[model samples]
Target chain A: HLDLHHYLLLSTESSNIRIYYCFRNIMKELQENFKKLLKTERVPVFLTSSGTGAMEASIVNFFKPEEDVLIVVGGKFGERFFKIAKRFGLNPICYEIEWGDYPKVEKIEKYLKENKNIKGVFIQICETSTGTFYPYKEIGEVCKKYDALLIADGITAVGVYNIEFDRSNIDILITGSQKALMTPPGVSAIIWNEKAHKRLGVNKRYKYYFDLEQEYKNQKEKFQTAYTPSVNLYAALNEALKVINKIGIEKIEKNTSIMSKATLKAFEEINLKPLSKNPAIGVSAICLPDSIDGNKLIKFIRENFNMYIAGGQGHLKGKIFRLCHFGYIDIFDTLNQISAVEFALNNLGYNFDLGKATKKAIEVISQYKGA
Target chain B: HLDLHHYLLLSTESSNIRIYYCFRNIMKELQENFKKLLKTERVPVFLTSSGTGAMEASIVNFFKPEEDVLIVVGGKFGERFFKIAKRFGLNPICYEIEWGDYPKVEKIEKYLKENKNIKGVFIQICETSTGTFYPYKEIGEVCKKYDALLIADGITAVGVYNIEFDRSNIDILITGSQKALMTPPGVSAIIWNEKAHKRLGVNKRYKYYFDLEQEYKNQKEKFQTAYTPSVNLYAALNEALKVINKIGIEKIEKNTSIMSKATLKAFEEINLKPLSKNPAIGVSAICLPDSIDGNKLIKFIRENFNMYIAGGQGHLKGKIFRLCHFGYIDIFDTLNQISAVEFALNNLGYNFDLGKATKKAIEVISQYKGA
Candidate 1:
């Protein structure tokens, strides 16, 4: 997602105020729609450029340096949370798990008990890196019991994978414009609980650029940002939010979960193993055969089939590729992606049945259930 | 000229990186052209989001905090240089002048003897606020005698007004994208003389985002920014820079000087007094009748005429209205602006003459000497 603040070279002046007006109107609409669809009124919204920017804002502003944080690490994103916290001089008691597995809440609780001055817990609702969803509701509860703010990275989970910020006791729920928001990568949102806001005031060294105090002041006054903002992207975001409000989050998440399950089942039937055993509620990751490099496969699919599937980032690069079924993607798009993968694998001498994968995905999409 | 770096929020990676790319591309193209045109082998280059950002990079990176700086203060921008230097904890010895008066290099030489720790001298090539162009060549020579770097804030002068950065022995030359460069307000550039670069190595304690060391590393490696950037703005900047290169700086400056003189002559012949008697090299600032409020007059033109002329900023507020004849404005635009001012003054029941200003402007435009 794009951070608008970094690019604005000029300090605030009343002259070019129309641009900032457009920026604020679009973001406010997104937050309004998010609250309405997700059925939450307790959301304290903070807008940022990327998923990481939102995550950093949550950690840096809400917690003091040298404070303890329980980072539930599974994929690259969770690990990033730990790194970001450490950069602020915070020692995170990391509850590590394999890429395919979700971290257990009991283990995290034990780690929190052992850690002193523990102020917050960082959790990923859906890890985009490994296609695994951590148990957010339970983790949120554990955090509340320990008097710690439960910060959830819901970049991929917010809309496609349903999350009720208030019901789950998720103190801070962060998301990006790209994944479930169905917009281009440029903006993000952070919804903090009241506890986190109070804690933010306790940490004073957060500075102005990432400073919560000034952002809060600016947002309160004009629904505007403290820095120069991306008015064009905000225009796109306003439209995207309207679409989200119309469909509602429950239906969107149900559709995404169904698409994900169908894709996973198709992979299983074709003898292709899903990367994560406890799959991400939104996207799917599957390991390619050793002969088929994920990078090359991704490149081939993107170049030949016009399908932009994501490859593993960091250490898992060239090993596993992801087929995301979130946001604006529907049953047709999912089938097309599966078909492309099957075609690419077959051409590379890795036998995979295209017909069966398509049939299975269709069946689940037609009979998808929502609660 | 907004110094973007001062206000930019760094945590937004995509926007930060996008700003970096946009700025880098602008800096690269400008430097490449300067090198090709000047026939230089290699040169040190820098990119910042605001003209102010580039100015800060030039000041803080090139000199230590304890160094003495000789500031030539004539207009608001010249005063800004003093304030910025003071922000970096630099002790400034100012050769102060009244608002419309030109900063005399002879006066600076007398002050140079009194300040012993002076490492550099800061002055604006064009005193944008007052429309007074300082004698940079003379000032550069004076700084050379005392072994002090001559830093030029070329924000309003670079393209519309020409300066031989190398030939004049100007140690630091800085500019912003919005003014004479014809780009939107998002990027700024700093091209340092050999002497300034040598001093950069010794300075530490600079903040992370504005740090020169990291920018140098990132620019050389990937043409990528060290942070998230605004790609859309970068695209806009690319288009802007293309226009600058096509016209060449000499042609741009020649046209601007012609307009400046024409506008000034028009003001004089019509009995309208200009802000500065020696006229700023690039822009022409004219004072409204004593009866007409400058801000209200500007507002009337903006609201009624749809013409956006700048009102006097800071202390000059309600004193003079500035018409930017720099970057993209042509003969017709100048004529229309004069007409609008006539209409506005007439509407306010203050002015008597209608076509006199236009005739005077045309006469000066035709007679001014240029290649």
Candidate 2:
């Protein structure tokens, strides 16, 4: 599944002039693919670098320097929004939440009611650090009621979970190439509604590379980027999107949810508890027992089984670990991941039944009938 | 020569982790190839977007907001420095030169002596619009004597012309992928000395995407970009650089010089004159006669011969035309270009000797024995 044969074939013929001539067509097709996947016609998508760059673009384009904004920080990725906002000189009022806990919509509404001058509300749909999924639909309603734009960082949530951009009233939605898009990292796509566009028109930031207005004008008029873009990356992304469109995003989302549930069920068989109170579909964060070190278990799994899993970040480091079931993954991958965890835990002298996790994972996998 | 067979082969096994593991070695090899081509040990190259983005990086990294700088405007690209500086809120002292004329070093030195507050001197080595090659070595010396950074926009000058970075004392040198580097357009590279790095360290620009400090640290520590880079473009650029390194920059420069002279001789035989007082090697800008329309002539050549050539920009619109002989081009390309121009001009009611331009071009081509 990680093979780049088709991507290589597409890139070999990518000359500047040839790429330029076909760029508009590729962009149109890519946008159509995103529209189908995102299920939105009111929001327009623009491609850029990674999610952080897109977040910076959303902040710089929608708000001027020193403008008041509200940032909801649930985890590391959510905290990134606060940093980017501060870097751009915005007055960000950070609403902090516990690492594994979801943000309460009532608290967000009360804050919005108190601070009536907030220009935008920045939050993540899925906090990748602790694998917690926020109540973005309800939060989007609060932003709408308060007349503030809602920028949703859906880097891990977009394709892994079903997101209705216009229905959720998301003003700006951002996603990256690596997570659920199933392509290699490097490119990100941003979708914004007309309200965000109108707010962007009043922004006076002196940006050149990440200028959304120039990008919009060029993409609208010439169907090209404001600057030279990576044709090879775009070609790869087009192929990845074709795969997603063929399999259907709904099926992919269903598969991810099934995989996440199966992994959690296997963890339960091994007596491992989940860290996230409101768990996301893409990843399941498990809290390591006091007897087992999270980092050592991750290293043992990679060294013994030749598989890599993510360790915890920030304050959760050495206490929690994350298992990803996102992007081009299936039942076999989930079963193998659960088996590796069982083997590593057993090797570390933790009291767990041999093959019990694998049996539970197999039972969960047998229930799913779709490919 | 344009086939990406090797590029495809290299990209077929490109997994994200694999690409990451091999990125440092690829960047090291690429830097070695560039070192061989540019013959410089003092200046280190860092890759980014297009030349324009690199130009923005050079400005934002070296100068703070409201800082004084000297901009030598000879053509369209030279004027870009003024606009970018102004956009960053820098007070750029514009030293305007005629479109087809080169900037005098003595005048620049006089300006530096009078101002004493200029932080850097920004100019293009080869002005693409007018085909003018400035005296960059003398300008570099003037900048050194005045203790100001000398930034040379060598987008069209790098491989087509012989430039010794250390010998010329250039603080910063910038180039693009679409020019003499022979790769597709998407990436630009900037090279600078310790002096420029020191200047960049003190800059307080609130930039994220184009942050040179972060890029430099990432490249130094992990041999990776701060953001996800287009690996396929880097693969293609590596291939292109290998070709350049094998041929030797001196021979490539000789070939371009031969091609430029051949094209000029052909134009002279057809009673056409070059626009620039000091013309560059890669392109030749010709001012059309009042009886002939430049745009119509260009369109005629493109339609009849299925070849594309660049038209004039800005004030030179409908007055001048340019023929490019850079990047993976040979003597045959020059001959074909001259033939197309001859054919187009003759079709446009300009009476000239039939096949006279071809004979002059062939005569010039015969003088060069090396590839």
DockQ of each: 0.13, 0.31
Clashing pairs in 2: none
Report the TM-score measured on chain A for model 1: 0.90
RMSD of 1: 7.0
> What does the lDDT read for residue A82 in candidate 2?
89
The positional error of residue B71 in candidate 2, measured at the CA in angstroms, is: 1.7
lDDT per residue as tens, model 1, A65-172: 678888888888888888778766677888888887898888878877876467888988888889998888988788888888888988888777567666878888
lDDT for each residue of candidate 2 in B126-151, tens digit (9 for 90 to 100): 99999988889989999999999999
Model 2: residues with Cα > 4 Å off, grouped in runs: A1-15, A42-48, A290-308, A314-320, A346-350, B1-15, B42-48, B290-306
TM-score of chain B of each: 0.87, 0.94
Off by over 4 Å in 1: A1-75, A78-103, A123-125, A150-179, A182-193, A199-208, A223-225, A369-371, B1-219, B226-228, B268-290, B315-319, B349-352, B368-371
